[model samples]
Target: MTRSAIELPVTADDRRIARLAALAIGLTLAEAAIPSPIPGVKPGLANIVILLVLLQYGWRAAAWVSVLRLLAGGLLLGSLFAPGFWLAAAGALVSLSVLGLARHLPDRYFGPVSLSVLAAFGHIGGQLALAGIWLLPAAALLKLLPVFAAAALIFGAVNGVIVARLLAGPVSSGRQSGSCTPPSIP
Candidate 1:
């Protein structure tokens, strides 16, 4: 008797990862398109997607998406080595690190909202660090920190809300499928 072979379809997790990566890239472009009074400041909307990816998929996938977004944004905007690119790379690295660490916390502690907030702070801190390294020494732009911090707080809250909402549906579905893992607390 000849037996027929069956093909297994791609898992939901795989589909989710692809979708999140695409979303991250799209958001990155949108954020990049927004004009800032100062060149280095951004809403970092893409970080929201990165945070969601880290929460739902894993750090590896999140890192890949972040790097892709960074490179693509730089290429699209014709600013590969511009100070803004460096600032963005710094922010992305810091935020991704925070998300990776947060992934280890107990789910009851952080959740999406808190995780978003932590990631935002890390993003801003990274930008500040980069600015200090590249621009602050000249004293020409040191006065911008307060404005940058305020923008970070406002945009961070917005990104946090977007992440929280994106994760809600997945959390509910994962719970139903018995595939949900409690996210790390902040």
Candidate 2:
């Protein structure tokens, strides 16, 4: 869908937001390229953008940006239907949901770190759920929860810090400018 079709106001600010999303997609792809100890696990650095969009633009913008990132990233990487793609898609959906819910809470209530924790846990849970459905038995998947959780915690916190840094300036400026209000705290 075109930018105008998304119901977001077509001001310069909206264009700026779109540009930011594109940048986030690029960042995510770069993050994905970094080798990890486990093949499929990632730091989910791009999720900071997703969280920021959800906070600044609203869920619809966040969701659409996420879908765009997933599709574009998969196509660019040539991993559209690969197992990793499915895992990433599931994780993204879960992370988006968590961020959506978190948006309801006052910004000061949770902080970026806490939101990242929730998103990371949701991301890992989604992957585990997919694994159970498409490959392993539930019992087998359960065996890996500890490992996944640990990775999620570490990566999630890292992503959260990055996001917090990125948002601190823009969000505060937006608030001061009366361009937006902090989302309600859940």
Candidate 3:
């Protein structure tokens, strides 16, 4: 694969975004250490960082952070270009798109939790769809949708709560919402 070259130097904001991506990547690695009863059922702890980035820096920064985490985490886990990476990339893309749309909703009607839930469902849906089209390609895979949805709902709510709490903190809101500030890491 050909890589693109950057003509400009990395800015302070880029460093901050890299720090956020590193945090998400760390969580992804740690989550990988835990065993799940179901193959695709994981709490998605790294999502908290993505959701936080979304609320603070908008969908563009969140997209960057999510992609960085996936690439870095996949490489670290030796899952790059594997089936898992394709599933993860699809999920991340869907989740980012969901966040992009959800962010436009009135603040009074929906917040991080709602947005998180939407992204979570989108994430799982994307993975399931990809699995159906590529990996399994069987009607039996459809049976797992409900299970994945349940996991997404539960884990999404938990992650949403964590992100909401982070947003509630003074450090993450106000003047620093659009820029990276040293907020307390959860």
Candidate 3 residue-wise lDDT, 37-127, digit = tens: 9998889999999988877777888888999999999999999999999999999998888889888889887887888889999999888
Candidate No. with top TM-score:
3
Q: Write the per-residue lDDT of candidate 2 for residues 6-100, one digit (tens) a residue.
A: 56448765575667668678987798779888756778877888777776677887787788888888888889989988988998899888888
Candidate 3 ranges with C-alpha deviation above 4 Å: 1-7, 170-186
Candidate 3 TM-score to native: 0.86
lDDT of prediction 3: 0.86
TM-score, one value per model: 0.74, 0.79, 0.86
In model 2, pairs of residues that clash are 104-184, 104-186, 105-184, 105-185, 105-186, 106-184, 106-185
- Ordered by lDDT, highest first, the candidates read 3, 2, 1
Alpha carbon lDDT at 120, candidate 2: 92
- Please give the CA lDDT of all the candidate structures: 0.75, 0.79, 0.86
